[model samples]
Target: MSAALGLLAVIVLTAATGYFVAQEFAYVAADRAALEQAAARGDASARRAAKVIGRLSFMLSGAQLGITMTTLVVGFIAKPALAGLIQPLLDAAGIPEGATGAIALAAGFVLATLIQMLLGELFPKNLALARAESLARALASSTLVYLTVAGPLIRLFDRAATRLLRTVGVEPVEELHSGATLEELGDIIGKSQSSGHLPADLSGLLDRALSFGDLTADEVMVPRPQVSTLPSTAPAADLVALIRETGHSAYPVYDGEVDDVIGVAGVREVADDALDPATPVGRIARPALLVPGSQPLYGVIERMRESGEEFACVVDEYGGLAGILTFEDVAEELVGEIADETDAREDAPTTGPDGSWLVDAGMRIDEVVRLTGLDLPEGDAYDTLGGLVMAELRRLPCPGDRLTVALDGASGHGEPDGASGHAELEVVSVARRVAEKIRIRTAAAPAPADRPEISDPPCAAPRPEEASWTR
Candidate 1:
């Protein structure tokens, strides 16, 4: 009867141990962001869990105390009770009385430990970690009750631990953390994308949003050459033509040159008044936002928002008009392309005959590499395909110029599977003294560069001043 009573007590203690173990693991692994999101959506359980997670150090100490105490009590009761049950079996197996008791006791200890370690520790811990958020919500209320009962002892232990740490020159404080680091979050997104839990487009957007802080205005801006501008002293007819040709809502009004500009004129604002052919373009211009090219995109966006201006002229180190960026550009960096009715897709890449691709020189090198499935080369010295070709030719590229180069690498969109190939790049058109349209002819597979050739004698390397802004 006593042994049976002792066994019941041991089972109860083991259950308590399991509770604490589960509570510890669940909260440790729980996604706090998910909890907060749930709370925002009016989940009562999630709110309670968030509270406990907020005071993680205290809650954790309570869990540890409960686990330790329950384990100790279970061990004390289990050995004697289990030994009593084992002794008779040992004797019936013809073991001698003196040796039988000792062996029975040892066996009892091993059995109790195995049962406790498996049922009380490992099982619940695994269960909690696998379903962390759900388990945390379920356990939070009960844990709070436990902490209320054992608050004094938990605090005492925590204080002692803090003092011990201070003695060793370490400051002890509550170690509660709520969110994953950027790198960890990125890794999670990558894994989710690979496992098909997240769509590729959504994953890419999320990754870009997280990385927006690292981008500079220069990286996302439209270079100066791509922007249309009108001389501030020009007639209103010029403004009308500029808007009609570029299909832009706004254009910079420069005094003499693009660098000596005054302000931006919106077509709608300019058109609001009666059209006078002789009206100076500067008469309708609004103040243009000037920002440094090196400014981080986040700060640029904030500055634009605070100033109530969407268009900014990005200036380089020497204060030259480096480029222009709009709110749409920064937004596109976060959420991918924001297409509109006015967007000209005619210049976009297209499929050509015989495994050839029609590409735009304005396309980013990384993007071109992705689309062509050919290992087009790249270096930090250039960013656009046009720039790369120009650097190689060492001169102004003209229509009909062709170059045969070995394909070596591809990146960003994960194309070509790191294969090598040879490609013929034929210039189809030139605009603004740069290659505007390029035809890329790709072979089926990677091959060694055997017969390198070029058509039209290449020019000498351009002067730094000429290539700096042109390419």
Candidate 2:
């Protein structure tokens, strides 16, 4: 073939290679959910794109075949053409008798490979990934036609691959996997946070949001001991006093025992002119909204919303009050802590003189993880640093209580890495049998200097508490 026609063929073949590369990546990276959404909206191109993704393995095989065939053809056409065109140039420069052909061939091969890789591979691949949804839709029809023509060959190749995979105990699926599990997403978020690809606060919020649905009322409630309640027969003045002292608007009024919660009373119930101080508190209380401790937070929120209750009384299996779950508790689960004017600034975690963190023992375990970059173990039995401490100690904590736990990874955000370290948790204060405040110091963390360390702490059996906290 003439050098001019050969070069044109080379250009067309390289373009074809680019088309397959773009199609392959675009379909792979395109958001499956987004494509479905568009298809639902009557976008014909997106409808076709969605179909392509349904047969991912076959589509990908066809794309690979196109890329390989076109790439080889481009090399076959371009090399000899390039050599013929360059030989005259080499001859004109040096009038070489033997060296011109060799020099021309080497130069032509380099030029063809560069053109094919840059234009046919890297550039298209990046563009396809960045604008995957749009390109996937744009090329869907053309890709379908190509695949239809190549179906027999592609199917044969795919069946062979499936056989090989099955022989090794690997099963091939039709579609590429999409969404990740929460644990996998957490690992990604952690790496992004550490690499500064995501800001710490936003990353943390996202991590919480992803895992929020998996939380239950039991995991995010005020423990029964920490919950303040009133007897059904308590005087109106008693209810008023508890409300004012705790700065909480609502109180659960129980019958005989805290477990037998009868109804809830709010400050609004205290404004009655007809009521006397000596009147029974239950007389003004509204019907309490009760929920199971094991209910998921989303279901809890739905129940609360439908019932028009700002809080729910979570009950254990035997129909006893376990804890009170408020909307604020749900909000805090996503946005970390929420403080109002009533909250004491002193109660917030602060740096000690020796660099230890003086934190509330009731602080959530996730918050503690973010603070110290230590991988303290987590289990269904506890969700707070205080709970973890109590679990490790096997008993409620007391003043100057200390325990050292091994770390799984220094990157507090992600999956456990092989990197090793440890953290020391010291109970700084106990109030009414609860570990109300503690000091935390961990190796490789910025907050605290070294503290006395206790290793693999032995836990004691949980004991009944003489409680103190309200709200």
Candidate 3:
């Protein structure tokens, strides 16, 4: 009976070890998937599943270690009894008595390893992967109990491991439970949406939320041309009148052109100060925080949070004013378009006939690229369509000038017709001679070819820049 109990103990230890291993690995996979889904705009279910799996994973790790240690101790303690039980079998098989103990020990160890590796580790892990949500939910409570019981021991082990790792010139693995990165979370959300585990709108909202990290101040800022400002020389009464007419909370104060902006004035301050009517706008203005157009929106948000500033002036590399970015701009990127009580303008500056829109002349190129699905090149030098056009052309183009824009294939090759797709840029229009503004018109070109092929131009001269701004 003692021998039988020893054998039973070994079996239980092996099984527990396997179970913990499988649980740990499976939870890792599930957590990774969940994080990706969250980033991709996945539904709450995926995120919840991920969270449960992550918590359970740590518990599983502790359980595995405990079970392994316990198994070693128990097996060592039971070795003599287990060996005695196997002696009879070895004798019956005509094995030497001297070798019986060694044979029995080897056989028992092999059996335990096999059972742990297969039944405990592999099978449970496969099951968990197949139905992660269900498995995670079911295992959560038990795992928590294990974690609570083993917390102190786990911490001690972790600290030791960390020190050992540092001694070996390796960084300690950060505790795995922190959470998933934005991109990884996005992928999981995308998968959930594809699997019909989440609703479309909610998934889309989540994706947009993740995108807030990638957005920049330039992409969301109100362009310089679109900003309403008070001249520094303007009287306080005139500044107040302009603010009332525009219904804006704040206005940039400029000495000359908008590019020469000195600071920002808040309507509330104007009301509170009740400054003399002849007071210079600069006298009422507050110092402005200036940010580069290339600054990421996330960084801008952090800056706003740390500085307690509400407005930032975006500028180009030339130190010229580019636009104005507000806290609301960053907020809108995370939560979608936010129209406030004071935003009375019905028509945006750059609407198209089919509802496809042009970014305002002053709008940041990054924002246009995000909203319009345009593939703009990356660089710090330019942040608007006008700037991009000017860079590419090298010279200011006349109304009838034509230029070719190339679209690289998927493999980044100039394939006009091949498996990848055609590469070509057709001239749509050019700058209006008098106004110095380019009026681009859209025209249907042949579908991109898989291999290189050039189509003949129908027009003798490039189409003239259209006079109307609407299209």
Clashes of each: 1, 5, 25
Per-residue lDDT over 290-319 for candidate 1, one digit per residue giving the tens place of the 0 to 100 score: 999889998898899899998999998997
lDDT of candidate 3 over 1-471, digit per residue (tens): 488787787667666765565556556655566454763685554454455555553555586686678667555745655666777899899998789879988776666556555766677778767866556545555566677788888878877877998999998545465567887988888788778898877876787787777777777888776788888888888877887787777888888877888988877567765468788888879887888878888888778778788889898888888888887877776665667777643444453564334333333544444444344454566656556555555544333333333322222111122212211222234433211333333223434322221243322333544433421
TM-score of each: 0.76, 0.75, 0.54
Identify the runs in model 1 with alpha carbons over 4 angstroms from their true place.
1-6, 29-48, 96-102, 130-138, 167-169, 269-273, 306-308, 338-343, 347-361, 364-457, 460-471
Q: RMSD in angstroms, all models? A: 6.0, 6.2, 10.0
What are the lDDT figures for the candidates, one per model? 0.79, 0.82, 0.62
Per-residue accuracy of model 2 over 122-228 as CA lDDT, tens digit each? 99999999999999999999989998999999999889989999999998887767879888988898889889899989998998898898888988988888888
Lowest-sum lDDT 10-residue window in model 1:
462-471
For lDDT, candidate 2 versus 3, the one ahead is 2
User: What clash count does candidate 3 reach?
Assistant: 25
Model 3 TM-score, 2 decimals: 0.54
Select the stronger candidate by lDDT from 1 and 2: 2
